[model samples]
Target: MSSTLIPPSCGRAIAVRAGGLVEVVDVEGSQVGDLWAIDVADPRRWLSTSHTRDTLEQLFPRVGQSFVDQRYQPILELVADTSPGLHDMLFPACNPALYAREGSPQHPNCADNFVAAAGQAGVTLPAVPDPVNLFQNSAPDADGRIAVHAAITRPGDRVRLRALRDITLVLTACAVDFWPTNGERCTSLRLDQLDGDGN
Candidate 1:
Protein backbone atom coordinates (compact mmCIF):
# COMPACT_ATOMS: atom_id res chain seq x y z
CA MET A 1 0.00 0.00 0.00
CA SER A 2 1.22 3.52 -0.81
CA SER A 3 -0.03 6.78 0.63
CA THR A 4 0.16 10.46 -0.38
CA LEU A 5 -1.40 13.73 0.66
CA ILE A 6 -3.08 16.22 -1.69
CA PRO A 7 -3.35 19.81 -0.57
CA PRO A 8 -6.58 21.72 -0.85
CA SER A 9 -7.70 23.25 -4.14
CA CYS A 10 -5.12 21.23 -6.06
CA GLY A 11 -5.10 18.18 -8.27
CA ARG A 12 -3.10 14.97 -8.46
CA ALA A 13 -2.69 12.23 -11.02
CA ILE A 14 -2.13 8.71 -9.75
CA ALA A 15 -1.36 5.54 -11.63
CA VAL A 16 -2.75 2.34 -10.23
CA ARG A 17 -1.19 -0.92 -11.23
CA ALA A 18 -3.28 -3.91 -12.22
CA GLY A 19 -4.81 -5.61 -9.19
CA GLY A 20 -3.80 -2.72 -6.94
CA LEU A 21 -6.15 -0.62 -4.84
CA VAL A 22 -6.61 3.14 -4.61
CA GLU A 23 -8.27 4.84 -1.66
CA VAL A 24 -9.31 8.51 -1.64
CA VAL A 25 -9.79 10.19 1.72
CA ASP A 26 -11.79 13.34 2.28
CA VAL A 27 -9.68 14.56 5.16
CA GLU A 28 -11.69 17.72 5.54
CA GLY A 29 -15.45 17.70 5.67
CA SER A 30 -17.42 19.06 2.73
CA GLN A 31 -14.55 18.82 0.25
CA VAL A 32 -15.43 17.91 -3.33
CA GLY A 33 -12.98 15.88 -5.40
CA ASP A 34 -13.68 15.30 -9.03
CA LEU A 35 -12.43 11.86 -10.08
CA TRP A 36 -11.88 10.04 -13.35
CA ALA A 37 -10.33 6.64 -14.05
CA ILE A 38 -8.78 5.64 -17.36
CA ASP A 39 -7.09 2.54 -18.60
CA VAL A 40 -3.41 3.37 -18.95
CA ALA A 41 -3.19 1.42 -22.19
CA ASP A 42 -6.50 2.27 -23.80
CA PRO A 43 -7.23 5.66 -22.19
CA ARG A 44 -10.61 5.67 -23.88
CA ARG A 45 -12.48 3.11 -21.83
CA TRP A 46 -12.52 4.98 -18.56
CA LEU A 47 -14.69 5.08 -15.49
CA SER A 48 -18.37 5.29 -16.32
CA THR A 49 -20.62 7.00 -13.82
CA SER A 50 -23.67 5.18 -15.10
CA HIS A 51 -21.93 1.85 -14.75
CA THR A 52 -20.54 2.74 -11.34
CA ARG A 53 -23.89 3.94 -10.04
CA ASP A 54 -25.68 0.87 -11.30
CA THR A 55 -23.13 -1.27 -9.53
CA LEU A 56 -23.52 0.77 -6.36
CA GLU A 57 -27.27 0.35 -6.49
CA GLN A 58 -26.83 -3.36 -6.90
CA LEU A 59 -24.40 -3.63 -4.00
CA PHE A 60 -26.42 -1.22 -1.87
CA PRO A 61 -23.57 0.53 -0.11
CA ARG A 62 -24.44 1.54 3.43
CA VAL A 63 -22.73 3.75 5.96
CA GLY A 64 -19.14 2.65 6.71
CA GLN A 65 -18.84 0.47 3.63
CA SER A 66 -16.49 0.72 0.65
CA PHE A 67 -17.39 0.08 -2.99
CA VAL A 68 -15.24 -2.03 -5.24
CA ASP A 69 -15.00 -2.14 -9.02
CA GLN A 70 -13.72 -5.65 -9.52
CA ARG A 71 -12.25 -6.80 -12.85
CA TYR A 72 -13.96 -3.72 -14.29
CA GLN A 73 -16.92 -6.03 -14.40
CA PRO A 74 -20.57 -5.16 -14.14
CA ILE A 75 -20.97 -6.25 -10.57
CA LEU A 76 -19.26 -4.02 -7.99
CA GLU A 77 -18.97 -5.07 -4.40
CA LEU A 78 -19.70 -3.16 -1.26
CA VAL A 79 -16.65 -4.36 0.61
CA ALA A 80 -16.94 -1.50 3.08
CA ASP A 81 -20.23 0.41 3.15
CA THR A 82 -21.31 4.00 3.53
CA SER A 83 -24.57 5.88 3.58
CA PRO A 84 -25.96 7.31 0.36
CA GLY A 85 -27.52 10.72 0.03
CA LEU A 86 -27.68 13.06 -2.99
CA HIS A 87 -25.08 11.16 -5.05
CA ASP A 88 -25.13 12.31 -8.65
CA MET A 89 -25.45 9.56 -11.20
CA LEU A 90 -25.72 11.64 -14.36
CA PHE A 91 -23.42 14.59 -13.83
CA PRO A 92 -20.50 14.66 -16.25
CA ALA A 93 -17.10 16.25 -15.92
CA CYS A 94 -16.83 20.01 -16.29
CA ASN A 95 -16.26 21.17 -19.83
CA PRO A 96 -15.76 24.51 -21.55
CA ALA A 97 -19.42 24.69 -22.46
CA LEU A 98 -20.39 23.87 -18.93
CA TYR A 99 -18.10 26.60 -17.63
CA ALA A 100 -19.59 29.02 -20.08
CA ARG A 101 -23.08 28.04 -19.04
CA GLU A 102 -22.10 28.58 -15.44
CA GLY A 103 -20.91 32.03 -16.45
CA SER A 104 -17.21 31.25 -15.89
CA PRO A 105 -14.82 32.28 -18.60
CA GLN A 106 -12.30 29.59 -17.71
CA HIS A 107 -10.68 27.49 -20.37
CA PRO A 108 -9.52 24.77 -18.04
CA ASN A 109 -12.26 22.57 -16.74
CA CYS A 110 -12.33 19.06 -15.32
CA ALA A 111 -11.85 17.73 -18.84
CA ASP A 112 -8.66 19.73 -18.97
CA ASN A 113 -7.41 17.87 -15.94
CA PHE A 114 -8.05 14.54 -17.61
CA VAL A 115 -6.37 15.64 -20.79
CA ALA A 116 -3.41 16.99 -18.90
CA ALA A 117 -3.04 13.78 -16.95
CA ALA A 118 -3.18 11.74 -20.11
CA GLY A 119 -0.64 13.99 -21.75
CA GLN A 120 1.68 13.69 -18.77
CA ALA A 121 1.39 9.92 -19.19
CA GLY A 122 2.33 10.28 -22.90
CA VAL A 123 -1.16 9.60 -24.19
CA THR A 124 -2.93 11.84 -26.70
CA LEU A 125 -6.63 12.16 -27.23
CA PRO A 126 -8.99 14.67 -28.74
CA ALA A 127 -11.38 14.62 -25.78
CA VAL A 128 -12.03 12.94 -22.47
CA PRO A 129 -15.48 11.82 -21.43
CA ASP A 130 -17.49 12.74 -18.37
CA PRO A 131 -16.08 11.95 -14.93
CA VAL A 132 -17.45 11.09 -11.53
CA ASN A 133 -17.84 13.76 -8.85
CA LEU A 134 -16.81 12.22 -5.58
CA PHE A 135 -17.87 13.73 -2.29
CA GLN A 136 -20.13 16.20 -4.07
CA ASN A 137 -23.89 16.36 -4.14
CA SER A 138 -26.20 17.54 -6.89
CA ALA A 139 -29.83 16.62 -6.56
CA PRO A 140 -32.58 17.06 -9.09
CA ASP A 141 -36.08 18.20 -8.35
CA ALA A 142 -39.39 16.97 -9.72
CA ASP A 143 -39.59 19.72 -12.33
CA GLY A 144 -36.17 18.75 -13.69
CA ARG A 145 -34.19 21.36 -11.84
CA ILE A 146 -30.71 20.57 -10.57
CA ALA A 147 -29.68 21.95 -7.25
CA VAL A 148 -26.04 22.06 -6.18
CA HIS A 149 -25.60 21.94 -2.49
CA ALA A 150 -22.99 21.29 0.14
CA ALA A 151 -21.38 17.88 0.26
CA ILE A 152 -22.74 15.22 2.56
CA THR A 153 -19.36 13.72 3.36
CA ARG A 154 -17.87 14.35 6.77
CA PRO A 155 -14.22 14.47 7.72
CA GLY A 156 -12.43 11.12 7.36
CA ASP A 157 -14.98 9.83 4.84
CA ARG A 158 -13.41 8.07 1.88
CA VAL A 159 -14.11 6.22 -1.31
CA ARG A 160 -11.97 3.19 -2.25
CA LEU A 161 -11.29 1.84 -5.71
CA ARG A 162 -9.98 -1.57 -6.67
CA ALA A 163 -8.40 -1.62 -10.06
CA LEU A 164 -9.68 -4.02 -12.67
CA ARG A 165 -6.95 -2.97 -15.05
CA ASP A 166 -3.78 -0.91 -15.05
CA ILE A 167 -5.34 2.55 -14.89
CA THR A 168 -4.71 6.20 -14.18
CA LEU A 169 -6.77 8.18 -11.66
CA VAL A 170 -7.14 11.90 -12.22
CA LEU A 171 -8.59 14.11 -9.52
CA THR A 172 -9.08 17.82 -8.93
CA ALA A 173 -10.18 19.25 -5.63
CA CYS A 174 -12.85 21.64 -6.87
CA ALA A 175 -12.56 25.30 -5.90
CA VAL A 176 -15.84 26.76 -6.96
CA ASP A 177 -15.75 30.33 -5.72
CA PHE A 178 -19.49 30.33 -5.12
CA TRP A 179 -19.07 27.65 -2.49
CA PRO A 180 -15.99 28.88 -0.74
CA THR A 181 -16.46 26.93 2.47
CA ASN A 182 -16.83 23.50 0.92
CA GLY A 183 -13.24 22.70 1.97
CA GLU A 184 -11.84 22.67 -1.57
CA ARG A 185 -9.71 25.74 -1.04
CA CYS A 186 -7.55 24.27 1.72
CA THR A 187 -8.62 20.67 2.14
CA SER A 188 -6.37 17.72 3.03
CA LEU A 189 -6.49 14.21 1.64
CA ARG A 190 -4.68 10.88 2.03
CA LEU A 191 -4.43 8.09 -0.54
CA ASP A 192 -3.64 4.55 0.43
CA GLN A 193 -3.45 1.14 -1.19
CA LEU A 194 -5.46 -1.79 0.08
CA ASP A 195 -4.21 -5.25 0.78
CA GLY A 196 -5.70 -8.45 -0.64
CA ASP A 197 -7.65 -8.98 2.54
CA GLY A 198 -9.71 -5.88 1.68
CA ASN A 199 -8.69 -4.12 4.86
Candidate 2:
Protein backbone atom coordinates (compact mmCIF):
# COMPACT_ATOMS: atom_id res chain seq x y z
CA MET A 1 0.00 0.00 0.00
CA SER A 2 1.17 3.51 -0.79
CA SER A 3 0.04 6.57 1.13
CA THR A 4 0.01 10.33 0.59
CA LEU A 5 -0.86 13.11 2.99
CA ILE A 6 -2.74 16.13 1.72
CA PRO A 7 -2.17 19.15 3.92
CA PRO A 8 -4.81 21.68 4.82
CA SER A 9 -5.92 23.83 1.87
CA CYS A 10 -3.89 21.66 -0.52
CA GLY A 11 -4.68 19.09 -3.19
CA ARG A 12 -3.15 16.08 -4.92
CA ALA A 13 -3.93 13.75 -7.83
CA ILE A 14 -3.09 10.10 -8.17
CA ALA A 15 -3.59 7.24 -10.61
CA VAL A 16 -5.56 4.26 -9.40
CA ARG A 17 -5.28 1.06 -11.36
CA ALA A 18 -8.32 -1.07 -12.00
CA GLY A 19 -9.19 -3.09 -8.91
CA GLY A 20 -6.98 -0.93 -6.75
CA LEU A 21 -8.35 0.64 -3.60
CA VAL A 22 -7.99 4.23 -2.49
CA GLU A 23 -8.52 4.90 1.18
CA VAL A 24 -9.30 8.43 2.37
CA VAL A 25 -8.72 9.14 6.03
CA ASP A 26 -10.13 11.92 8.13
CA VAL A 27 -6.97 12.73 10.02
CA GLU A 28 -8.83 15.14 12.24
CA GLY A 29 -12.54 15.32 12.92
CA SER A 30 -14.75 17.91 11.22
CA GLN A 31 -12.63 18.17 8.06
CA VAL A 32 -14.00 17.78 4.54
CA GLY A 33 -12.28 16.56 1.39
CA ASP A 34 -13.31 16.82 -2.24
CA LEU A 35 -13.10 13.70 -4.36
CA TRP A 36 -13.13 13.74 -8.16
CA ALA A 37 -12.15 11.18 -10.73
CA ILE A 38 -11.98 10.86 -14.52
CA ASP A 39 -11.68 7.73 -16.55
CA VAL A 40 -8.45 7.50 -18.53
CA ALA A 41 -10.08 5.41 -21.24
CA ASP A 42 -12.88 7.85 -21.90
CA PRO A 43 -12.40 11.34 -20.69
CA ARG A 44 -15.66 12.60 -22.11
CA ARG A 45 -17.57 10.20 -19.90
CA TRP A 46 -16.31 11.31 -16.54
CA LEU A 47 -17.92 10.75 -13.18
CA SER A 48 -21.41 12.21 -13.03
CA THR A 49 -23.05 12.97 -9.73
CA SER A 50 -26.47 13.29 -11.29
CA HIS A 51 -26.15 9.96 -12.99
CA THR A 52 -24.99 8.28 -9.83
CA ARG A 53 -27.83 9.79 -7.86
CA ASP A 54 -30.34 8.72 -10.44
CA THR A 55 -28.88 5.28 -10.67
CA LEU A 56 -29.03 4.74 -6.96
CA GLU A 57 -32.22 6.79 -6.54
CA GLN A 58 -30.56 8.20 -3.46
CA LEU A 59 -28.68 11.32 -2.54
CA PHE A 60 -25.96 9.95 -0.31
CA PRO A 61 -23.35 7.37 -1.27
CA ARG A 62 -23.43 3.86 0.13
CA VAL A 63 -20.98 1.06 0.67
CA GLY A 64 -20.97 -1.67 -2.01
CA GLN A 65 -22.28 0.82 -4.55
CA SER A 66 -20.34 2.06 -7.55
CA PHE A 67 -20.19 5.70 -8.53
CA VAL A 68 -20.90 5.80 -12.24
CA ASP A 69 -20.16 8.13 -15.11
CA GLN A 70 -22.52 10.00 -17.38
CA ARG A 71 -22.73 6.95 -19.60
CA TYR A 72 -23.70 4.80 -16.65
CA GLN A 73 -20.30 3.20 -16.56
CA PRO A 74 -18.81 2.28 -13.25
CA ILE A 75 -15.93 4.45 -12.16
CA LEU A 76 -15.32 3.96 -8.48
CA GLU A 77 -16.94 1.78 -5.84
CA LEU A 78 -17.57 2.82 -2.28
CA VAL A 79 -16.27 -0.30 -0.63
CA ALA A 80 -16.16 0.99 2.91
CA ASP A 81 -17.04 4.08 4.90
CA THR A 82 -16.43 4.62 8.58
CA SER A 83 -17.60 8.19 8.91
CA PRO A 84 -21.11 9.37 9.64
CA GLY A 85 -21.99 8.92 5.94
CA LEU A 86 -23.22 12.46 5.55
CA HIS A 87 -21.39 13.36 2.35
CA ASP A 88 -22.93 15.74 -0.16
CA MET A 89 -23.21 15.37 -3.94
CA LEU A 90 -25.69 18.12 -4.65
CA PHE A 91 -23.35 21.05 -4.02
CA PRO A 92 -20.66 22.19 -6.39
CA ALA A 93 -17.04 22.19 -5.44
CA CYS A 94 -16.02 25.20 -3.41
CA ASN A 95 -14.43 27.81 -5.63
CA PRO A 96 -13.20 31.37 -5.58
CA ALA A 97 -16.48 32.65 -6.93
CA LEU A 98 -18.29 31.03 -4.01
CA TYR A 99 -15.94 32.72 -1.56
CA ALA A 100 -16.29 36.05 -3.32
CA ARG A 101 -20.05 35.75 -2.99
CA GLU A 102 -19.53 35.22 0.71
CA GLY A 103 -17.36 38.35 1.07
CA SER A 104 -14.03 36.58 0.76
CA PRO A 105 -12.54 37.28 -2.63
CA GLN A 106 -9.12 35.75 -2.10
CA HIS A 107 -10.03 32.55 -0.37
CA PRO A 108 -8.42 29.30 -1.55
CA ASN A 109 -10.89 26.69 -2.80
CA CYS A 110 -11.26 23.27 -4.37
CA ALA A 111 -11.76 24.44 -7.95
CA ASP A 112 -8.20 25.76 -8.18
CA ASN A 113 -6.96 22.74 -6.32
CA PHE A 114 -8.52 20.42 -8.92
CA VAL A 115 -6.77 22.25 -11.73
CA ALA A 116 -3.44 21.95 -9.96
CA ALA A 117 -4.06 18.29 -9.22
CA ALA A 118 -5.08 17.57 -12.79
CA GLY A 119 -1.98 19.26 -14.07
CA GLN A 120 0.14 17.03 -11.90
CA ALA A 121 -1.76 13.99 -13.23
CA GLY A 122 -1.11 15.06 -16.85
CA VAL A 123 -4.81 15.16 -17.63
CA THR A 124 -7.16 17.90 -18.76
CA LEU A 125 -10.91 18.28 -18.91
CA PRO A 126 -13.34 20.69 -20.50
CA ALA A 127 -14.94 21.52 -17.17
CA VAL A 128 -14.68 20.80 -13.46
CA PRO A 129 -17.55 18.70 -12.21
CA ASP A 130 -19.06 18.73 -8.74
CA PRO A 131 -17.09 16.48 -6.45
CA VAL A 132 -18.21 14.10 -3.70
CA ASN A 133 -17.69 16.15 -0.56
CA LEU A 134 -16.37 13.53 1.83
CA PHE A 135 -17.15 14.00 5.51
CA GLN A 136 -19.47 16.89 4.79
CA ASN A 137 -22.72 17.14 6.76
CA SER A 138 -25.47 18.46 4.50
CA ALA A 139 -29.13 17.65 5.01
CA PRO A 140 -32.18 18.67 3.03
CA ASP A 141 -35.44 19.15 4.83
CA ALA A 142 -38.97 18.35 3.67
CA ASP A 143 -39.31 21.89 2.42
CA GLY A 144 -36.23 21.36 0.25
CA ARG A 145 -33.97 23.54 2.33
CA ILE A 146 -30.45 22.19 2.49
CA ALA A 147 -28.43 23.08 5.54
CA VAL A 148 -24.70 22.56 5.68
CA HIS A 149 -23.29 21.87 9.09
CA ALA A 150 -20.13 20.71 10.80
CA ALA A 151 -18.89 17.25 9.91
CA ILE A 152 -19.48 14.31 12.19
CA THR A 153 -16.43 12.32 11.19
CA ARG A 154 -14.19 11.42 14.08
CA PRO A 155 -10.40 11.32 14.03
CA GLY A 156 -8.90 8.51 11.93
CA ASP A 157 -12.22 7.67 10.27
CA ARG A 158 -11.78 6.23 6.78
CA VAL A 159 -13.65 5.84 3.52
CA ARG A 160 -12.37 3.24 1.07
CA LEU A 161 -12.98 3.31 -2.66
CA ARG A 162 -12.26 0.79 -5.40
CA ALA A 163 -11.41 1.78 -8.92
CA LEU A 164 -13.47 0.08 -11.58
CA ARG A 165 -11.35 1.37 -14.42
CA ASP A 166 -8.09 3.08 -15.18
CA ILE A 167 -8.59 6.54 -13.78
CA THR A 168 -7.03 9.63 -12.26
CA LEU A 169 -8.18 10.59 -8.78
CA VAL A 170 -8.02 14.13 -7.46
CA LEU A 171 -8.47 15.06 -3.81
CA THR A 172 -8.60 18.43 -2.15
CA ALA A 173 -8.38 19.21 1.53
CA CYS A 174 -11.34 21.58 1.68
CA ALA A 175 -10.36 25.10 2.76
CA VAL A 176 -13.75 26.59 3.48
CA ASP A 177 -12.95 28.47 6.68
CA PHE A 178 -15.67 31.05 6.25
CA TRP A 179 -18.31 28.50 7.29
CA PRO A 180 -18.82 25.39 9.39
CA THR A 181 -18.03 23.23 6.37
CA ASN A 182 -14.62 22.56 7.82
CA GLY A 183 -15.63 23.27 11.37
CA GLU A 184 -14.52 26.82 10.63
CA ARG A 185 -10.97 25.40 10.33
CA CYS A 186 -9.02 23.46 7.76
CA THR A 187 -7.11 20.27 8.35
CA SER A 188 -5.02 17.64 6.57
CA LEU A 189 -6.13 14.29 5.03
CA ARG A 190 -4.49 10.96 4.34
CA LEU A 191 -4.84 9.00 1.12
CA ASP A 192 -3.74 5.42 0.82
CA GLN A 193 -3.42 3.71 -2.57
CA LEU A 194 -3.63 0.06 -1.80
CA ASP A 195 -2.47 -2.69 -4.13
CA GLY A 196 -5.04 -5.07 -5.58
CA ASP A 197 -5.54 -8.37 -3.83
CA GLY A 198 -2.18 -10.13 -3.47
CA ASN A 199 -0.19 -7.64 -5.44
- Candidate 2, residue 199: Cα displacement in angstroms equals 10
Tell me the tens digit of each residue's lDDT in model 1 across 40-134: 76765666665555666632244343333323452222234242443444666666787688788674455666667567766665566555566
Write the residue-wise lDDT of candidate 2 on 128-165 in tens digits. 99899998898788999998999889999989999999
Residue ranges of candidate 2 with Cα displaced over 4 Å: 197-199
Q: List the residue pairs that clash in candidate 2.
A: none
Give per-model TM-scores. 0.74, 0.96
For each candidate, what is the lDDT? Answer: 0.61, 0.89
Cα-based lDDT at residue 55, candidate 1: 60
RMSD of each: 4.2, 1.4
Best of the candidates, TM-score: 2
